[model samples]
Target: MVLIKDVGSEKDKKLSVSEYIKLLNNSLSNLYGEVIGEISEITISAKGHVYFVLKDKITGYVLPCTIWETNYLLNGIDMEIGMEILIKGRPEFYGPFGKLSFITKNVELVGDGALKKAYEKLKEKLEKEGLFDNSRKKTLPLFPKKIAVITSNYGAVIHDFTNNLRKSGFQIKILDCRVEGSESGPELALSVRALRGEDIDLLVIIRGGGSIQSLAGFNNEALVREIANFPTPVIIGVGHHEDVTLASLVADASESTPSLTAELIGRSWEKAEQSVDNIQRKIFSHYEYSLERSSKILRLTFEKAKKSFDKILKIHDNTKQSLRHGMQKIKEKIKETQNGVSDKKIYITQQFQKSIDEVNNKCLFNIPKFILKKYTKIIKDKQDSLKTLKKLIETNNPERQLELGY
Candidate 1:
């Protein structure tokens, strides 16, 4: 049993061993920070938890540290007996073992050389697993309308990205988080997982430029795998031109700057607009050409039609003049025939009258009465035949037929 002051009860209380350890652990949680030293001894349990001893080289001081399997694996560093490392965590007393241990939540290599060695080692391992293969990468949507962004809210990274993004017609969902430091890796992984069931077209993780150490969170093994296997296509734009993080390598698309990422998202839309403009111009040009050609064809057709009409009218006038001339000649011929018939009738009457007077004188003086009677009868019959001939001529005349409206 142990006697301790209980803050909740505001009194001194007797606590069992388990309760005492719990209270100590609760207090130790507040003493969390980073610790750096050389690794002296390392062990891995069956459950994959890492137990390591860190020693200060100059002072020869040592501290025992333990990291859970999840955090150990996420840091992407294979512990060796003599390598230097930095662990960020708090001290906790293990009730079963009766030992105080530094519980590491995160771990990283200590120096630039060590970090580079670890980075290269992890890069080789992931490359062998085909996580960096182009075939495994997803394609960015041609027209992404909804985007989920994971980045630090307390910096210019988000602002640069948003400012460069297109102004309208995009639904951006941002998860504000730390982009550096020990907590950033897990937070980024969680942020990605949080958007698992979300309705988004794309995922973007970005951060401003940083040193290799500051960008170590982007190289987290868990975060790399998360981006590599993400359901939606992912784009990572972290660090400067000189930096390329593991997260960027495994992502479907990578950019050197957050502004560049925004440009890539809006590139397709810009191209589509240009294509539309080109098509519009083509359509207008085609229409103008067709209209001009049709106008020319219409003009030629109208000219042909007018010439044809004029020719027909001229031929019609010529036919009318010929018909008029022919009708006048026919009328003159009919009038001349009528005049000749009248003259012939007059001459025949005069000759017949003379013949009758001569007959009367010769026959009456020298012939008997019977002979005179026979001559009179013959002359009267001749006169009657002459009158019948004149009547037949009058009935068959063209002038008389015309007068009867034939």
Candidate 2:
């Protein structure tokens, strides 16, 4: 709606750039003076302002562009090299430079599809210089005792964050602020600056679900730069499934929603308990196998002793036949003596059984019961670990598992 007035430089009405700008402002009394298009060509000059072209129909025609230092100050765009943009401005003339141009008041970035070429050109320049390396990313703390949240206090984001973390026994301090649209950039930068407190563990930047335009505040250069340079790792929960901003890339971890971010923090604690339980299962399984093997070896030794007693009885029978018939009575007495020896063999067998019983009493019964106490303690420990894993899996609530997908 910006009116391009006919301020032709003729006769006594000479004008300076500042004076001309004032006249232009007066002539256009806030009729929403400019409507920036969705796509345009952007450029820069040595005089610290942006120059661009706004072409709608791809015809053999071009529109002049100009954005002064004040406009640039109010709306700070880092102006990536060869970036495509959409611009709106009021037409004006520079008397000294004798150049006619549009004084840009608003800008839009349309950097994909027909807009994609210039976007790729600028992205390549920054990427080749190593601006997007995974190694540059920071690690999130596992057990952050003190959490700092940056989000709107009156909304669902703060409610979701506080409820989840507080229920899980975390101490948090929230730095409440606006987080969307035209005015969000400066406020977010200010909120991040206030987190210079030393007691902070992890910082969470969050917002509830919002439109793409509403989410633009987070994509601003100042906000993104602040996130990249933050001391602690930042957790971004911008809450729009489709909008992944520059801030998302620079953050330590980005969550789709505030509730999901809180759950992630909760999962870390559960995983620690799961680790301890896994180790317990391994140790318990080893001891159980050892006890079973020892019992098998004891049973095999008892069977070997019974076989040796039978072989001794067969040798006794063979020796009696070797005796001559000359001394029949003497042979009879020797047979009786052998019978006595056989009776004594029965006594010896009884003694062997007594000794076996004693050994069994001391080893298999008394000592095994003592060792069983240790094994039983191990069993209890393993059981505790199993219970922990169950709790962890249940709390996470995997959707596939609920569908019985194993």
- In order of listing, the candidates' clash counts read 0, 1
Model 1 is weakest, by summed lDDT over 10 consecutive residues, at: 181-190
Compared with the true structure, all predictions reach lDDT values of: 0.87, 0.66
Q: Which stretches of candidate 2 lie over 4 Å from their true place?
A: 1-34, 38-43, 53-106, 110-127, 152-155, 167-199, 208-222, 239-244, 266-406
lDDT for position 402 in model 1: 69
Best by TM-score: 1
Task: Put down candidate 2 lDDT per residue, 162-242, tens digits, no spaces.
Answer: 676635568888887888663576678767877866578788998876765676667655566677778988889876636
Highest lDDT against the true fold, candidate: 1
Residue 246 accuracy (lDDT) in model 2: 57
Count clashing residue pairs in model 2: 1
For model 2 the local lDDT of residue 67 reads 78
Q: 46-92 in candidate 1: lDDT tens per residue? A: 99999999999999999999999988766667889999988888999
